[model samples]
Target: MHNRYSLKEMFFEHLTRFSAILVLFFLSAIFIVLIIKAYPAIHHFGFSFITEQKWAPNFELFGGLPAIYGSFISTLIAMLFAIPVAIGIAIFLSEIAPKSLKSPIGVSIELLAAIPSVVYGMWGLFYLAPFMRDVFGGNGLGLFTAGLILAIMILPFISAITRDALNTTPKILKESAYALGATQWDVIKDIMIPYAKAGIVGSVILALGRAFGETMAVTFVMGNAHQIPSSIFEPATSIPSTLANEFSEVDSELYLSSLYLLALILFIISFIIIAFAKFYFLKNRVKRKKRLV
Candidate 1:
């Protein structure tokens, strides 16, 4: 006999559809507003907004190159610092941690990620910033300090996601590695890490996205100088920090338009990272399929 559709499941499915529509609506609204506000600058500057570094508005000259550069560099530094620590945490929790300790430790790490970014900003400003300042001999308000603070802030996200990914690997896959007489390190290095590399990369991308867009946290710790920094010790400004710092107080309409263009660049950066993550995910899926065959 043929089964009829249940009203409850249909209702739930409609609810999920509504939820997705709401999310898309919100995303579209943000993008539309940003583009609408950004068009004046995009029209005026053409392609120079991305390539020119001078941001002064008095001469009718504004550019976002430095802000773009700073955001990229700081996020890069933070991701580099966070990746090793995150991987280590994932390895420990998923591979080596005592069974009894796993749940508590994992929960604590997730709790860290739950902390507000503004709280992190305040902590960085009051505590971590000064500590790094002292350690670095009064030159701490730079990419290094901002990146380090961001690294700590993003650690939980990267670690939690990675540990979850690694933990999801089939138990028999690990057992087979052990059955082959592989050492613990060999099993992890050759078997587990390679298998979960996609998820690990995805986790790292999530953390990097957070670092790239974090406004209050980076603004508080990073010296808000709108210049390209050659050394990590030199003070600089990220795109988000620039918007946070000056968006409200800036006077000219053109000036505000420039900020919107910066926002567009930021949106593009996020889009690129998300695209890369999806590409990697698809590539890994194909590899996994080949392995299964």
Candidate 2:
């Protein structure tokens, strides 16, 4: 026997396909436009554009190394500070917190995520920056400050998603483990985490992509210096910070093209990281599910 779709089903299916194709088309168009805008700098600098450190616009010199380095270092610091704390918060909310305390804490976390990025930037500039400067003895508007702001900005997203993931654990499984003399920690470590690994990983990857592309928050506190910072507390710049700080001041074609190149680089890095997580982890998860079946 052959199966046939109704008219509405076919129309909806085709519409969905068209929507997916439209998204791909827009992404390709954006990449093509960036390449076209960045071609001059690509031709002028060749591979050296990525390695050279100088960024003087007056001399027509431009390099992306410092910006790239700052982006990497700041994101690294953010993940270092954020991941453990986010996980702890998730665990507390999911398994440890009393029912009386959960809703208020959960709402507070959602409120943190609700605040604007620019507001986080301003708060970092006025409050966190000075506090850190007093404690660490530096200007405090650098990679470290930018990284902390990013950590705070991303914390709510990671914790909320992770808590939801943990909550998906089957009650039967947890009860059985408890009956078998498993402690709460053991059940959490051995069951809930393994069961919700995919969602947890996806949430972390989502936060990571955000950290890489975050603009206003980093721009306000990253110091926007074009040179490599010798210390984490010294001035630095990331691709987004640099683009925001100088995109309007371009008096030369090379300078503008170089900025476009920086944007393209940021886009490519975020795309690759997200694609890897989506493809690799999802495929492995599917295989694991099949095995269980």
lDDT of each residue in 225-273, candidate 1, tens digit only: 8788777777889999999999999899999999998998898788788
lDDT of 2 by residue, 95-190 (tens): 999999999999899888988999999999999999989988788889999999999999999999999989989999999999999999999999
Predictions in order: lDDT: 0.87, 0.93
Query: Could you give the C-alpha RMSD of every candidate to the true structure, in order shown?
Result: 3.7, 3.5
- Give the poorly placed runs of model 1, Cα more than 4 Å off: 1-19, 282-293
Cα TM-score of candidate 1: 0.88
Q: Please give each candidate's TM-score.
A: 0.88, 0.92
Global local distance difference test of model 2: 0.93
Q: State residue 273's C-alpha deviation in candidate 2, in Å.
A: 1.3
